[model samples]
Target: MGPAAAAAAAARPQKASAAGGVPARWVCALCASCFVFGVFVINRIWSVPEPVKLNEKALFVERTQTRLSEVYIPCQRKQNSIHIGEILNHVSQTHDVIMTLDKTISNLEMRLAAARAARATKQEKSLISADSDIELSKVRPKVFFVMGIITAFSSRKRRDSIRETWMPHGENLRRLEKEKGIVVRFVIGHSGTRGSLLDHTVDAEDEQYSDFLRLDHVEGYHELSSKTLIYFSTAVAIWDADFYIKVDDDVHVNIGVLGSTLARHRSKPRIYTGCMKSGPVLAKQGVKYHEPEYWKFGEEGNKYFRHATGQLYAISKELATYLSVNRRLLGFMVHRSQCGAHR
Candidate 1:
């Protein structure tokens, strides 16, 4: 309308500029505020102590229909921040968000909770009351399978021979997937591309079964820390799949034994099974591959590493929850035994 008012209007962002139902003005304000507040919030967030929840013990039921372990959380962490606003967060590391919907929605929440309670009751009825002598296959749930794999690659994250980084491991993984039924998958590092990584030769960690896969290393983007990529990738498995496993290409997996072992387990422990070692959590932090305050060393007791073991252990769905919940504290331990200098 007026010249002064028109100029002011022109400075404002368009309505379409807003994304995720937020407007351009809000987006601009949020961005500006975050730039100002990032250090402060990051400091506060980093200062927050992470949890120390142990894994929930897994029990299996034998039945034709399967006592499926399906846990659907009705109250998901809300993506929106406060009462009226939200940020576009693609968190590789997710912090559980809480949403308090309106009165009507709150009622729905109660209903859902009630339903979950009823389901728990049904489960209680289905479980053993006092019978230790009973074999469960009759009333037990059917077997359910979840499949995933893990391997390290060169900077390319593609399979190829490098000076000595991950080529052999990559080849072994391909063979494991092709020859054995053990599943394998790729990981792209998060902080930067793997290709840019300097060619550093690391000794072959497992020399037992080296001929299995055609291992050429491809670098995936992600920082290498003791538990960094493993924690993040395992956290993803928390969202999908019933069972998960991570393996290095040099490892030999006896698929037949693996399948039988899983099939027979009445209760599966959250374990770092292949090779177990323990130590305190490290306090050191990385700059480009930064470690958060939460990644501090653990209590005085020994802690074990599941990494050095040849990459062929099985985990049930429930274990995924623990990894997600404890990521901040357990995400960055590097296995130095695998590290070596370029030849």
Candidate 2:
């Protein structure tokens, strides 16, 4: 071949070798730059601030132990103060004692309830037996008069006055009972003063006249409502009449007029016949018909509700029976006419 062509071929081999060397140098420079960048990032991460860690569980346990030693341990060491264990023991014992007392009270209450039930049953049975002798089936009474009077052992004068003035006796009473179907009875409670003497006098009076109904309860001014309840109960137990009349011994009633008025309203069982007083309740103490428990009437209104005057009133048989049967619930409220008797 010619010298120029041989030289051109040698130049092509040198250019190929140089191109291969350029790629190897570029790879080495890139590897070196990557290593420098990695070192810089690692140094920056190491230089950054790091948060300190604490053992929180151990700290909490230490604080709790310190509080216990300071408060509870000191309390226990004090001579005058009680310990937690002692207090706990005392509370447990007190609870046991209270529980025992509660059980005892419950037992007593149950026994009392049973006694009351037994007494009620006995009273009902006795009344039924007495009813056979009275021949209640044959002679059903139409009107029953229950007179309220406060009679003591020394108050024979009052009873005598009642008997002589208005109350009919012996054949007159029997004739009235047979013809008009009316019965009059005096209701009284046992006296506190001279009880035995009073009881003997009452017994003697009952033996002679047989018109007195002596209650088992002791007499007192505060027990006026209770006496009224007993009077109703006794009257209902004795007879199932059409109308029941309650009158004070001091008030004289015209039997003819009362019977006529009752005949007109006999069909109406939900009526109460009496002198109803409607006026403002007196707030001052010691006034006649003064309301001692004015607060029960409320703060705004000063007037009293229309209620039957305590002197005399008549109730239907149904109302009388209801009052007698539910005496325990109604006894306190039945006599709240002008003022509270309990007060």
Candidate 3:
């Protein structure tokens, strides 16, 4: 090679290959350009009105998913020199990212809707001003048993099973209310999915059953404490019962036994009764009930603080009120089933 050619070759930046001999700089530049384009598209979409924005976003996601899947499916199945595996992986990751962003946007939209509903309810409450409110003695609901089942958006079958078997509804529900003076309600957060299919399904179920308490939060495994807090707060807002109870959906709650159990503590303030026990803090990463935030409790020797299991638990109106009022001050542990029990 000539000296001039050698000099020219040295001056030009050497192309670095990523996996499967694809240029790393090219991949980086493509990713960066896609990110910028995504941001710009999102900004433009968000500028529309709420109704239009939702429709537009849904359409955009559908089109994008279809296009990306069509483009990547061939690459995913066949081997190629252009790093098809890496491209497939990138596409999969991008889809996940989009889904996550969609969920977040949906949550924000639900919050706004919930705020509006709350405002309307508040207005109605102000108009009544307790003038038309029935006394507890006359109404006969001394205890509000809020079976705050930590359920998901897609768990319609489970909720239906609970409704058909243990928890009564329709005329049977009214009979229970009249006889036992105990009310049962299933609490759930709004859907985290992009479309409101789950939300609408739950709403339709509530219309038929009249037993669901929908909250202004997103449904997820780690959001149990927040959902519980909202459960108590909503209970207090709507009822003047002497006691409030929270139970899970999976637990078969014998309403008769529960009423008897709560009747004993009806007069007691700050009463928190349940099958309480202490368990060892699982510090290991892969164990069942592994504490991801284990350091919050203490060093390695610390056991979890004694708490009422999430299966079935009851609290007095006073304690529920305290929790409802002081939600901001309360610290929430991630493993909600093992904690959040307060006296």
Candidate 4:
């Protein structure tokens, strides 16, 4: 081969090698640039500043604590509110129970007070009745005036009140009977239920006091007129008196005034003396002064004939004897007659 051919070949190989090396260097430079960009991106992502990282951690902790506090505070407030509501409800219920108990206690106290008052009243009545009986035993058999106070089994308190106020008791009663020739007695009758507790109590009282004039008729509020008739008949049979007085147990009588008034009428033989009243005869039932057989009184609201008042009245011995003798016949007419005691 020629020198020129050999040189051309060497030049061609060298040009090829040089071209390949340039391409290799360009590839390595491109790979190095890509690696540097990846390293920069990793550093930017992982390698944060110390102060910035601490600030982020602190922010995260503060946000978590704030959230927890908000939740806990709301829950605690709700629990507190519920507890307060329950306490208020319990207090209200307790207050209502206390009020009810107080009312019950007040009622019991009132009842106890009433019972004590009643017991005291009964004891006072028993004492007065006992005193009256002692006085009655000293009275003489012969009396100028026989004052019969109408009474019943349940009228011990009324009798005691009269004895304490106007009627005399013990030594006073005995002195009055001895000085004035006037005898006072409580008039009563046996109970309808014979030998019952009521009758036994009355018997005990009578045995203790001996101031009661027991009647044959049964005791009843509806038979006042009949009781009055029986009283006159019985009084006449027992005592010899110038005047026989029928008085209600509830009446407050001035003994001095009564004695003086009776003395003025002592001369009259067939006298029936009392406070004269002309009240109307009540025919209606359930009335205060009701008359059962009011048809004979002329009309429903007709005024009765002027007569002695039934609460207190006096009859002469002759009239009392007449009433005693014809008591059975007078009993029928006593209620029908309008002239109350005079009839």
Candidate 5:
């Protein structure tokens, strides 16, 4: 073989080897570039804030705890909204219930008021019907004995019992007044609250019976002496009677016997007749027939002077006139004298 041919063969082999090495180097370079790009992307993904990172497979960025918390907050807000709506619904239901209860109470109150008004109307009608047949005398007549029966507004049942038992009614009462010249009347006074139901009831009763003596004094248990004095004064003013008798509503008396008993003493000028009694003066409070001025009776545990029992008593015209004339002075004296007396 020649030397030139050998050199050509060697050049051909070198050229072929050089051409294969160039292709392999280009492939390596492309692979390295791809790796660098991937690395940069991974670094960018990992370079996020501390709470963000790549998943195990590096397929995508994992949602961090902070992002998950942010998502949960919206869900929590939705839940809270639902809870608030439920509370508002409950409040609305409670309000409806309360309104219903209030309406029911108002209805009950109105019904009660209507019932009370109806009852009052019925009572008024009954009273008017009861008084339809009564006829009363217009002129004041001369009388011999004036009997004042002390009573109170609340003593209607007691007065009824008395009228049913001993007191005359209808024509019999008129006959007694006309023939016997004995005036018997129930004495009462105005109530503390003027023009009240009590006063109206009393006025209605007086219109029906024509047997009530209305006084200007106020009715009270403590002012019994004043009441008695007023009764004497009023009886003396109205009638020319020989005797003025004061009797309690609870007392039972035979009118025939009382008339006879008074007739015997009619001639006396100044006679006071009653059952005499002596009772101890009570110093302590809250006791029955308690005397506030017990010290005026000399001492504690002392007894009152001899005096007539308050249940029934009679005073002649002269004494009654004196009592009427000196009412203020005698009233004070009588109050002092009867301070410790049994009621």
Candidate 6:
């Protein structure tokens, strides 16, 4: 081979990468080049003068100080322009350094004036206040309630001791009212609350039951409106509540704790109250919201689907409005029971 050809062949990358099959020599060359370039960049950065930004007012002060040795004050004339003959005579009498300094000072003044005109908007006080109140009082309240009989739908022939769950809810509301001084509103949509005193719909009273009332308002749970579509219809009801919470008629919530937490976070813009969600549920137990597009639904480890079931959920006033206004925009799901994804 010719000398140049032999040199090029020797410099060429020969060995393949162990994993991705890229040339190993090329990788080494690239890494070495990056390292050298990084060092050069860092050295150049270190050598650069740390820039100091000066306010116009500050620079004006320094310029005023430099004018101290000169005897005559710069006279302000009322006429349209300064007399050039007078300025030239003054410069002729002054030292070259003073003349040079005066010229530099004049140039700085002219340039600063033009710059001030160009950048007047940026220099003016901002109309938007950083001091705006993010307090709850800034927004009108929106309250949503998950009023209904929410219990485990068990087809087991005998009932579980689950009926005992009602005692705490009534007592809980009384405690919230008497001790905390917040009125608790409960709406019951199902026929037999069985244990709830605040049952909004009664089976014997209404005959068919007002099951559709609460279900019509929520998304995934809209199935009373059609369980097969199974969007948790509960979130729709949240739009109505300034600060809405949807707990199962079964779960024991410490409203004192909940109220305090809510009060502390009253100023927060968006809040979704719950324990962090995790894992998967193929079982019809616990909480379930079917998401066909799970990957786009959340990050790999983040288990929140498009919605959660009625076990428990809470929304702040702002989020209630967001949910209400955007309900039409949210494309919900449809299910085919013959080929059930859950089963």
**Colliding residue pairs in candidate 2:** none
Q: lDDT of candidate 5 vs native?
A: 0.72
The 0-to-1 C-alpha lDDT of every candidate, in the order given, reads 0.39, 0.65, 0.69, 0.74, 0.72, 0.42
TM-score of 5: 0.54
Under the 3 Å rule for N, CA and C atoms, how many clashes does model 3 have? 0
Consecutive 10-residue window with the lowest summed lDDT within model 3: 131-140
Q: Estimate each model's TM-score.
A: 0.32, 0.53, 0.54, 0.52, 0.54, 0.34
Model 5 Cα displacement at 136 (Å)? 18
Query: Which run of 10 residues does model 2 get worst, by summed lDDT?
Result: 334-343
The segments of candidate 5 whose C-alpha lies over 4 angstroms from its true place after superposition are 1-141, 282-302, 331-343
Candidate 1 per-residue lDDT, tens place, 48-114, comes to 5432121221222233224332222222223223322433353322332322333345445434533
Q: In terms of lDDT, which candidate is stronger, 5 or 6? A: 5
- Regions of candidate 1 where Cα sits further than 4 Å from its true position: 1-149, 152-183, 190-222, 225-240, 266-272, 279-310, 329-331, 334-343
lDDT score for residue 63 of model 3 = 100
Overlapping backbone residue pairs in candidate 2 total 0
Candidate closer to the true structure by lDDT (higher is better), 1 or 2: 2
Between the candidate structures 1 and 4, which one is better when assessed by lDDT? Answer: 4
Each model's Cα RMSD: 40.7, 19.7, 35.8, 24.8, 25.8, 33.8
Q: What is the lDDT of candidate 2?
A: 0.65
lDDT by residue for model 4 (175-214), tens: 8778888888899877887788988998888776667787
Per-residue lDDT of model 2, residues 35-143, tens digit only: 9999999978876543212456667889999988899776667844556668889999999998788667645643454344334423553324544524543443455
Residue 65 lDDT in candidate 6:
81
Where is the poorest 10-residue window by lDDT in model 1?
Answer: 51-60
> Who wins the TM-score comparison?
3
